[model samples]
Target: MQKVVLITGGSKGIGKATGQLLSENGFKVYGTSRNPDTISNHPFKLLPLDVTDPNSIARCIDLLKSETSRLDILINNAGAGITGPIEEIPEAEIKKNFETNFFGPVAMIKSVLPLMRENKSGLIINVTSIAGYMGLPFRGVYSASKGALELITEAISMEVKSFGIDVVNFAPGDVATDIAAGRYHSPLKESSAYKATYGKTLELMDTHVDSGKDPMFIANAIYNIITSKSRKVHYKAGEPLQKFSIVLKRLLPDRWYEKMLMNHYKL
Candidate 1:
């Protein structure tokens, strides 16, 4: 029996690369995009899905159920980034970040759990970020949302482990993607205290992302996770330094860790 896998935000970047790779690995892969019609030259089947909308999520899952009797794996990869100073960012913008990055994946898991539980075996992968561990300087809200996702994945893994459902918090550091294009920027008020600093920080962040590891770095990680027998709760993917720093951050003192980050961003 071929394993059925669904990936959100599969039109581009890590999602696209993962879907393509998973299909090549012989999984019955379905990739979702807000505009499925726009997905071109992809080997995997495209499904229209909007994770922020419950109705859209339900409809897409139902469509999948209609075609396949079971869904073996779910990859919650659909997300966006927001950049700006914490105080200057609007409440609505922060809410939007949580809606897409956190709530969307939560809703996805809830909707699919019954199907997974029925099958007695399944894997759920949530795409979080390294920024989630230690909040980024300017992208505070974005980091917070992914930080929430990291915990969500952890909690769900504990609850579902006995049920034969595997959950992994898949955190990727910098990866080359169109996420910057979709990123939102906080309004820069003329009187904003952090206006100048935010601009420089955001620019440096963009530069780091522009020089990020390839999307294949993440795609290959996902492929390995799905195929492996061992159950790892968290998998970090990216350049070696970025991936290893998760350990370094934990071992370092609070002020020292923060100072390291500040120095990296030239703050």
Candidate 2:
């Protein structure tokens, strides 16, 4: 039987690329978009899913179970980026970031595990970000949410390894994606004391992204993870620096390491 795969946030970007690549490789691919109708025609399937909605998640998983009998891989790729000074960040937007970036993926993993346990085999990939390693400058809370998801991915990896279910955090640095266009802003960010630096920070966000790696860079990395005999708990996808920055952060003293990051973000 062909391996069955499901990816969230599949309407575009990394999720869509992964779905296409897997489908070409003979996996039965099902991608989820909140607005499936908005997606253009594609070779692989698109399932409507709102990862933040419990009912929506349950419904999608149940539908997958009925159709595929067993799901071989689950890729939690649904995430969002919220930008602003930390203090000025709205409570509701912070919660919204956590809801979409962390909680949604958690729910997906939990809902799919029972079926994976029954099969005694599966791989779960949590698409995190490079910012998760540090409290990112303007995008601090968004970083926090991804950081939480990364830890959750690690914990689940350890807990589920024995069940033949492996979970890995795929932290991709600035990939070229429409996610930039989807960025959310705090209400009072422009009026805050950090206003002078805020514009520059946003410019930096775009700079890194415009120079970022391709979505296929991530798609290929994930493809390799799925096909490997055994996988690491974490894999960074992007330019050499992205994959290595996390290593340097681990190697250097915190003061020095943070200095490097601070310099990069012009903080």
| Best of the candidates, TM-score | 1
* TM-score for each candidate, following the candidate numbering: 0.97, 0.96
lDDT of 2 by residue, 1-267 (tens): 899999999878999899999999999999998888877887678898999999999999878877879999999999998999888887888998999999999999999999999999999999999889878788899889999999989899989889989999989999988777897976444457987677778888888888888898789999999999978998887778876888897899989988887788777
lDDT of each: 0.90, 0.89
| Residue pairs in clash, model 1 | none
Worst 10 residues of 2 by lDDT: 183-192
Tens-digit lDDT track of model 1 for 1-267: 999999998888999899889888889999999998875788888899999999999999999999999999999999989998877788898898899999999999999999999999899999999888887798889889999999989899999999899999999999888778789988666788887777778788878789998998889989999989896999888778887778888899988988988888878
lDDT of 1 at 73: 95
The Cα error of candidate 1 at residue 251, in Å, is 1.7
Best prediction by lDDT: 1
Each prediction's RMSD to truth: 1.2, 1.4
Off by over 4 Å in 1: 188-190
